[model samples]
Target: MSSKRESPLEVFLNRHDDAAWRETLVTLLPAIHEVDRNAAQVWFHFYPLALLRAFQAAEDPARLAQELLMQGSWYLKDQLDASHTFLYGHRFWPEVKRAVVQLAGGVEIPNGRTLAEVVREVARAAAAERKVDESLTIGIAAVGLMALQQVGSEEFRRAPGEVLIDRRHLKRTPEEVLRERAKDEGQGLFGFLRTADRRWTVVWDENADDRRFKALDKQEVASGAQADKRPWHETDARCTVNEGPIPVQCRSASCGTCWVGVLGGADKLSETEWRERKVMPLFGYVETDDPKPLIRLSCQARAEGPVSVVIPPWNGYFGKYLKRVREGTSEEAVASS
Candidate 1:
């Protein structure tokens, strides 16, 4: 099949403004978010149009993502569930409803909301609560952002190689990955980003003078230094943008170790797509290639746009197995199609 004609979501992502789509999402977001309209607009700038359309009506995509993303924190998950409390809430139906319930609780829970409205509400809530700092939880949010960007942007093309044979939740513990990340922080992804810019800052703690993470992304993130820790913070200090050769692996797509999480730049980075089975999560972060996904494998993720993301400490090649199970269980899959 030639594929159903590109959808409105596709058109919207291509900078095409469909009045119906605009009306749909706009109707859902709170008026409060509308005041700072540009911030909400940023989501449109980075969100993938295709994915947004898919999730707007479907609940599983959004729910499964939340389940995976929230895997790291019981407290956060409870908080999320608390958001549901009464009624079936969002557990069993359209993904948009769950999203609407999750982000727009307390206030802004009136009338009808389109996916775009939900998107705007979410961005505003995220901006408002720069406070909740569970790295894992935040990481999940990053992946969601990435999915949006992947669906809407033109950045994604065909997935590169067969690095990821499957897409599923990786069970590695944070500490496990952290230890591994420590070993390669300087030589892997960090090395790549540093070579691109000297002024770049990667902070563990968003607020810190002379934040450690900053210049490290621009230069070598010194290894073997007690000073260089697993999840280090940038001093928030200023520096010169040094340019150098970025050291990388599978600059073709073999190693899953070079993913980074963008903390600040949602607009500057190139858009992403569901490449090689959405490899990031399989590698251990959260698989998603959203233009603005917080987690991205450095080797696969390239940026022409400016964005600041956290570097995931470790990675692996387990996606192939995951893909096999999914394919095997799927009925009518030709057994080996």
Candidate 2:
């Protein structure tokens, strides 16, 4: 009797389960450039599972990251085109092509290489060099290779045979970065009062030198102090870009508009409260017990100290879309049939 075969989506997902994906990311992170790594990390957090469903139904089985890189602008209509920013920035694609070719034993990859092709090459290299079983899935290997190529190796030693999560790349330890920013801002006559109060720095844009905000001790930064009106609160001017700078509405987590990815200071952020915990999954951003995950609703996260964060270029109500997919009622599923 013949056995049932798993679908491409299932096979891909099973090969790169959450734990394995995270492990691979941690391992290859050192090889990726700091800027690219930061951008990729944020992109990883914002990856939409809804798109995965769409791809599955469309019979187009591709790497989730690659799909995002190629077609995310259409699906995430409200987002600021993060894929274009990262993939095209500083000639990133050429570097990835070079890494893929090197891993393929100097064989020239065809121009316009797809994510699956690059991953297959990396998987072959990893299995041969590491002497690991060939059963390792290409999805996991691809993510690892992509990260490795993006984050080029540091000057110390050869790349590890077995990848491990290295926390050293976390750059500015939250506490230190926040403290220095606060000091640099300088408090005058109220310095004594401010000294008594703990302040944290929220680096909203990792790429921008000036895109940062100060949060007073124990105060939720999302609250938007009267003295400093947040960009989201400015209604007088129209934003020229889609997904304009930390676009937010309703300072509370109720709007799901203030989501962000913690790039450097996950530990320094306030623990996830019940409201945020309940609401985040609803936003389809994250569903985990980790008190301070990379994806967070800015309104819900209060800073204990300094943190570097990346604001996702878009936000929307996709919880219902996911629910419909799970229930087999999604329009994509019906249309595909």
Candidate 3:
């Protein structure tokens, strides 16, 4: 049997690099998360089409998977109904998902629209229908587009209509969640004396009520996981693949497996040093000069106060590959000239 052909929207999504998408998403960051814009930005970095495309194009995917230290599910299609769970706008997923399908199905191929335009159009429509803040729908709309790309137009149209989130998760409103994200517990009165051994809470997953670990003052985020002796690997697939609440291979920054997105309390962490600054871009995770950025290697970041972080589903070394591609393109341009 012949394989199915890709849809125009899928082709469009596949054509752009993470930077292009980031440029658009960053502009709407203030609209996506009321309190945790940085964290949401990090979440976008969690999944990259370029990385997924590289994996798909590899000659030996299994071997490449090993080299990349991939864990959990990278393909958004497999979790289409619930992929936006981590985003605050997850509450609007049902409407957003439906809008994505309707938009892709109704539009003609090569409509001359960028992915950024599509995201805004869907978000604006969903907000108008839901009568909620437009900001609430922005992230979900972006997620819906990603789903459409991963599953293709046909599967997207046929995707399940029901919401996949557990009913229990609906107890808190998005506004309440935003308030919680902005919360910061101060050290007790004795803390001012500097005599108490200060400790802080690190929330690995915000959606979970009890998914947290404690870290001592100035303790590395990954190191605190060592104190949690629970059989985490038995429960979380990511933990199963690697070792801690945050999957880490080289605790010394040799491997990019321990990278995470700080949803809150970025300033509470230690400043980004030279070694981490150099390796993050090489790991293809972050490219910034900020001392403390949203994206960070868990092994290198030390907590000074309570923080919330999101671990990516996969990790890899793709900076060299991207650099080579850029050089090749430059050479072609020179020859053409």
Candidate 4:
């Protein structure tokens, strides 16, 4: 809950309940501020904008540089973690930071930069170096700026933005908003994942990961290993198996069957992904307008680690339905015009 137009701090944060914002601050205090008992309670009173004012107040490049780096570092390890699961297996920071380095490579940028500041720097660097698609690049730079800072400093506080961000750094990606809201509302991850445990032990089938009925059309379960073996669809419908029947439909992205909400083990799951984003609307469950929602189709979504999830029964041709609605609106627009 933030506003589009820049306005006073109170006005920018006008929509969302203060309680949730304060709770997030409270939750992040230990990792971010690392303040004392009295100060922790007062941290929410200090908005990111207020911090920005202080950061900008100091004209010292060395001091500002130190602070900005700390801020960037917090964004990666602490703040972003609030929403997106920072995964392993990536050395791609250079590609993302190409422009940021080429220009600022020599000239010093304020290391105490805020999310907004780092983004602006990326934009400037991109313009200087001639690059497009600076958006994701900026995000990577933010992560990098922080990583570099962590190597040097200890104190860092991230003034995270919720959806409809009022300030710069608090600006959140849709995925982040979903995750934050889910955590705040106790709706599990993106209002789907919850703390849980998988009862039945199952092997990882990358191919099967994207299937509604992993237990179906498979010899592993049907193999004549023993009488106890049964298709998990029948045996695990109640969410009791170590490997449950992943909710699915169309055995394709066409239907969002295999859409399972995480119960206890969200970290065990892999990540919200490209294909998952492509098919989410097809299921009619529009948690967020994000391209990828953490709640994913079991068929399309895979878990790198073990995860426990609750499967939803209801399914609809939501993508088609949304298209129809859009078309109808377009017709209405024509008539009105």
* Number of the predicted model whose lDDT against the real structure is largest: 3
Candidate 4 on 1-337: residue-level lDDT in tens?
1123322222212222334444443443333211121122221221222223223334453464353322112123344222121211012233324533333334334344334454446444543444433433333343333332321112222322222222432343434433432332233444335324212222222112232222211122211112232365463353223333443334455544445444233453445565566666544444345433335555554433333343333333334433443465523234545
Worst 10 residues of 3 by lDDT: 328-337
Cα lDDT over the full model 4? 0.34
TM-score of each: 0.31, 0.55, 0.86, 0.28
On the 0 to 100 scale, the lDDT of residue 33 in model 1 is 22
Show where candidate 2 strays beyond 4 Å: 1-39, 52-93, 97-196, 224-245, 334-337
Q: Runs in model 4 with CA error above 4 Å?
A: 1-244, 247-250, 287-292, 330-337
- The full ranking of all candidates by lDDT, starting with the best, is 3, 2, 4, 1
For model 1, the superposed segments whose C-alpha errors exceed 4 Å read: 1-114, 117-200, 208-211, 214-258, 265-294, 298-307, 311-318, 329-337
Better of 1 and 2 by TM-score: 2
True lDDT of residue 317, candidate 4: 36
Tens digit of lDDT per residue, candidate 1, span 74-160?
Answer: 221122222111111111112322332344223433444444443454444444454322222222222233332333222212111
Runs with alpha carbons beyond 4 Å of true place in candidate 3: 1-8, 11-15, 109-114, 158-164, 237-244, 325-337
Which residue pairs come into collision in candidate 3? Answer: none
Error of 4 at 196 (Å): 24
Q: For candidate 3, what is the TM-score?
A: 0.86
